[model samples]
Target: MFKRLILFILLASCFLGHAQTYQVEKGNSKYNAFAFIEAQKIYLKLVEDGYATTEILSKLGDTYYFNDDLKQAQKWYAKLFAHYENQVTPEYFFRYAQSLKAVNKYEESDVYMVKFNTSKGFDARSKMLEEDSNYLQMIDFQSGRFEIANAKEINSSKADFGPAFYASNNQVVYATARESGSVLRERHTWNNQPFLQLYTADADENGVLGNPKPMSNLINTKYHESTPVFTNDGRTMYFTRNNYDNGVYLQDKTGTNKLKIFRSYKNKGKWSKPEQLPFNSDEYSVAHPTLSPDGKKLYFSSDMPGSIGYDLENEFTRSDIWVVDILADGAFGAPRNLKDINTPGRETFPFISKTNTLYFSSSGHQGLGGLDVFTSSISPSGSMGKVVNIGKPINTTYDDFGFIINDDTQTGYFSSNRPGGAGDDDIYTFLQLEDLREECEVHVVGNVTDHKTGDPIKDATLVLFDMNNNKIDQQITGDNATYTFRLDCDQSYILRVVKEDYTSNEEVITTPTSSGLMRTSLEIEINRIPVADCDDIGPLLDIQHIYFDFDKFNIRTDAGYALLKIKAFMELYPQVSIEIRSHTDSRAPDQYNELLSEKRAQSTRDWLISKGIDASRLTAKGFGERRLLNTCANGVACSSDEHQLNRRSEFIVSGFGEFKDCD
Candidate 1:
C-alpha cells in the first residue's frame, strides 16, 4: 500500500497531460472499474490534438497495465521509452520491462531492463538467477514475494493477527481487532475502538485450535495488546503493547502513541498484570517480540536506533532487525542491529525457529507487493547470517507475514489475505516439506552419573544457562542415565546439572560462533552429594564453568562452574592476573596440544583481561596434558573420564598483566 501511494505520487509529478485532460472525480466511484479505460480515452483524444505529454502517456499506459490491457499498455509505454530513450529513470525501465514481458516482447523487455539506471536491482537479480533455474530457489528467503500462508477464519472472528502458538501446550494467543469479551477498550494504532486485545484458543496436541477466549485483564490492558509468545516453561508471556504517557497525557493533555514490549508472569493459577520490559529504547519504537525456543535469546522487531544506511523520517515506514542477548540476570545486552539482515526497505515480524533459524517479514527485499516472509540461521553464539527468500506458493503479490513455526513437527502458522479467506487477513497453517535432509546436528553426549556410585541419575534436568539467567537451551537427561544436546558448531553454552538427590553439577561446552571442526564430542559428569548430608561442602554445588578455545584463550564457552567462580574470584580479588593452563588428551600430537593448550589457556586469561584482571600478572601455559594426573596419554586407550581429565583447563594465581614481560 505504501508502495502504491508512492507510485501514485510519482505518476502525478512525472506525467503530464494534453488539452483534453482527464480528472478522476472525487466521487467517481470507478477507481478500480473502467477508470483506466476512461483515462485511455482522454489520453488518445489528447494525442489526436497533439497535446499529449510523456507523463500523461506513462499514466495512461499504467492505467492500461492495471486494466490488463497489456497490448495498449505496451504501446503507450514503448512510445514514451522511444522518446526518452536511455534518459528514462529506473522506475521507467522497471515498469516498461514488466509491461514488455507481459506482452511477450522478451527482446524489447531485455533492452529496457538493460537500460536500468541503478546497480542495486541488476546486481541482486543477476546473483539470484545466476545459478538457480527456479526463481523460488534462486535466493534464500526472509520476506518479499516468497513465503506463503493461508488466511481464513479460525473462529467466527472478523479479523485475527498477532498469532503465537504454544508448541508444548497446543494453545494459541493472538490479538484481534474484532469486538471481543466484555471489554470495549480503544485499539488506537489499529483503527481506534478496541483495535486489538489478546485472545486465546485451545490448540490441541495436534495444533488444532478450539473456542477463542479473551486474555485476562492482567495481560490485556485497555490499550492495544497482542503478539504473545510463550516461554518454553509457559511461565511467562512476552508481547507488544503501545503505551501513552498516561500520567503525562492526563497532565499535558497531549495524547501521543509509543509502542513497547510488556511481559506478564504466570503464578499459582493467575497472571500478573503486565509490566514494561526493562532497557527499552525510548529513542526508537519497539514492537513484535519473539523468543528463542531455549528462552535465552529474544528476537524482536524494532525501529530502534541502530538502523544504519536509512533514516526514520522517511522510513517510519522502514524498520531494521535488532536483537539483544538475554543476560543471566534477565536484563538485555545493548540491543544490537543486525545490519546484515536489514535492508533499505522495512523489516519486521520476526519468528525464530528452535534450530535458531530466524524468519522475518520484509517489504524491502525483492517482494511481491505488500510484505513477504524470509529466513536466516542464527549462529549458535546467536549471530545472524544472510537471509533466504521462502519462494512461491508461500508468497504472492499480497501481504504475507506473521510467520510462526514449530520446526520439530514441521508445522506452523502465518497470516495472509489470499483468496478464500473468511475476511481480510486471516491465519493460515503450513506444514513445510521435510523431504530435504538438512545437516545433522552434532551432539554433546554423556550422562549425569553420580560421582560416587557412577550410576546415571534419573529425572535430572540438564539446563543450559548463559551469563544472563535466560535459559539458552535445555535437554533433560533421558531415563537411560544419559543426556544429549545437539548444538551446531560455534555455540558457547554453560550447562547446569541438577538433581533432587544431590547438589547440582556444572560442566563446560564450548563451540565457536562458527564451526571449526567437522565433529566434536563432550562428556559431562555430575558428582552427587549424599542425600542425608545436606550440609556437605561438595564442590558440585552451583559452580559456574567457562571454557576457552584451543591455543587461543579467548572466552570459549566450555563446561563447568569455574568460570563463574573466576568471575566472582576476580570481583572479590580485583587487580589479579591468573595463569591459565590448557592440557590435552595426549593421544594427539604433543607440540600441537602444547601450543593449542597454551592458546586455550590464554583464551580464559583474556576473558578476564577486560574484567579488570591486570594483564601483566596473567600467564598462560600449555602442558599438552603431558603430566596427566591419571594414566591417559596421547596414545592411551583410556576411559572417557581419563580422556576428560586429560582435556582439563586450570588456572593459578599470577601477578597481573602489567607486571608480565613486555612483548
Candidate 2:
C-alpha cells in the first residue's frame, strides 16, 4: 500500500527519487526540509515505473532542487526537453534549455534556447542570463597555487571572520570562536555548540584593520554570539546568537528549544540591555543576524517552518537563510525565506550590499567540503539571483564565514580557521578588483596614494573590472592602496578607489589586447564624499532569444542569442555570475516547472561553462511559478501579453561576487 501510494505521489509529483520515498508517503516534515525522502522516492518510483510525464519529470526536478541535487535535477529536466520536438509551452522549452546548461551540458543544451527570446518574462530574465563569473566564487582550492591565508605565516589566528563595516565610524565588527579558550574550542557539528563570539576593531577605508578586541559581554552571550552588524548611526547593534534557550545543543538529546538573534545598545559610556529578538523561535532556529546598511531590515539563518518548503521543528533539517524587514516602529516583520537564493542544500550567513548584492555561506551547494561563500543579487524589480559559490582564495576545504563589504571602496572582510590560523578563526581583509582582470600576460599597475600626503594608501580599496563593468579581484595594498592587475590585450578595464569619508575615484583603462598586453595604472585621488555617492541606476536587460532541440524539453543549440548576451554581461562585469531561471509555459502539467526550470537554468549554466565560464559562478533553478505567469493559473482574465510574459526563462544576479562593476 505504501509503495502504491508512493507510486501515486511520484506520478503526481513527477521527478522522483529512491532515497526520498518513504518520507513522502508518511508525510512527516523535515527539520531542514530539503524534501521528504519519501516524497523523493515516490517520485523516482514513477519515473522507474514508466509513469514519467513532463509533469512527473518536473516534480522529480523539484525534488532534486530541494536536495541540492543540481546534477540529478539537471538530468531529469534535460530528459524532458533535450529530445523535445513539437509545439511545446514556452515555459518548459525555455526552462529545460537552461537546466541543461547549468550542469555543463552546454553544447547539448542550447537547442531549447530559442523559445525564451520571445517568451513573456524575457525582460526580467535577460538581466540575469547576460551575466558572467568573477572572483566572488572564491573557493580556496581554486586559487591554483596561491598560498591560502591560513597557510601563509601572516595573520591567521582565532575564530576570526564576519567583518561588518560602519562607513561613518571607520570601524569593523566580526565574529570569532577565538573567545573563551586557550586554543579555539572544538566546533560541534550537530548543535554548533556555543563557542563563537563578537568582536570589533578599527579599520581604515584602505582595508587596514587594527587588532580586534572582544565585544563587551552585554552583547556577546555566555554561549555564542557571532556575526555582528551595526546601524548607520553605529549606536544600535544586531547580532546572531546561539543560546541555551535556542535548543541547538539538544541534538539527539531531545530538548525542545531553538536558536535566536539578539540586539543591544551602547549608552552612557557603557554597553547595556541585551535582549532576545522577538521573532526568533524554538521550533526552527535563527542565527547569524545581519542588518541592511540602512538598518531598516534584518537578515538571518533559520530552520523555521515555511522556509524553502521545510519545517524547522524536525531534528535533521539543514540550515537555510531567512530575512525580515525592520518595520517603521523598529519591529521586525515576519521572516520570509529568500527563495530564489536558497535551495535544498544549506544557505547560511547572508550579507547584503548597497547594490542589492548578497553574500552567504553554504554546505549543500558545490564547494571544497566545509562551508564556502556564495553570492546573489536582487534585481531592480526585486527578484533574486540563483546562489553561486565564491571560489578560490576566499573559500576552501575548511569553512569560510562572515563575508561583508565596504561598498564604495571595494574592500571586504571574512574569517577562517584553516590549518595555519593562530588558533581558531582569524579575520582577513581583501579588496574588490576590476582593471587588469585577465589571468596572465601584460598587466596594469598603479598606486592609491594620499592626495595630500603622497604616501601610499595602505589598505585603500583597489577594484579591477572587466568589460561588463563589475569588480573581478580585491586585495589590500601591502603599503598603500597601490595595486597591480594582469590583463589580456583588447579587453576593457575599470578601476576604482574608495576609503571611508573619502570621495571615491574611478579610472577606466581600455587597452586593445589584440594589440598585445600593455602595462598602465593611473593613480586614483580620493576626497571624502558622502555615502550618497552610492546612488544606483536601475539595471536593464533584453531577452535575446531562446531555442530547443529535437524532441527535448531541455534547451539546445540556437539558444546562443540569449546565452551570448549573458556571456557578454559576464565579460562586462567580471564580478557577476547569474542564476538562470527556467520555466514551463502553462500548456504542460503544473509540476513541470520544478523540473523544467531546474533543467533550463542548469542547461543555460552548462552552456556558459562550455564557453569557458566557471561552474561555481552560476546557479540554476526552476520556479514552476508558471503559476504566476500562467494567466490560466487562477483563470484570471488577462491579456495575451501578460500570459506570454509569464511563460519565459529568466536570469537574475543573485550575489556580491568578484564582478561588481564599481564606479
lDDT tens per residue, model 2, 1-663: 999999998786753454345434333232233333545666676668675666556656656544334456678876665444344455555445445544555434433443443543442232222221111232332344222233122233444566777547377776665534464555433223336666667765466777667778666555666676777777777777665543334322244445677777777656666667887765667787777656677888887767552634322566777878788977777788887766544678888887767789875454543467877776765567655565657765556777776678776777764555665556677665531122323445566666666766766777777768777876456422335555666667787777764567777787664523244434445532212111221124345335443213454454676677667666655556566666655445667556765676677778888887878777766776543644456445666555555545565665547323222
What TM-score number comes out for model 2?
A: 0.42
List candidate 1 stretches off by more than 4 Å. Answer: 1-157, 181-194, 245-256, 281-283, 312-317, 435-663
lDDT of each: 0.60, 0.58
Per-model TM-score on C-alpha atoms: 0.47, 0.42
> Best lDDT goes to which candidate?
1
Clash count, candidate 2: 168
What are the per-residue Cα lDDT tens digits for candidate 1 across 1-663?
999999998887666532133343311223223345555665666666675466667666766655434556778888887786555445556557556654556445544544552423553332222222122323323223323345343533455776897647587787776765585555332222345778887775556666877878667656667778888888888888766333221211122355778777889878887777775544555788888877877777776555752553331335777777788986777778887778655688898877888888875554444467778888877667656567655665556688888767777778765556766557776667642223323445565676655676767788877656678766565434555555667656677877663677676667555522222222334432222211211243343223343334455444434565665655554554555666666665777777777776766667667666656656777777676778775566777655655565665544432333222
Q: How many residue pairs clash in each candidate?
A: 64, 168
User: lDDT, candidate 1, residue 495?
Assistant: 76
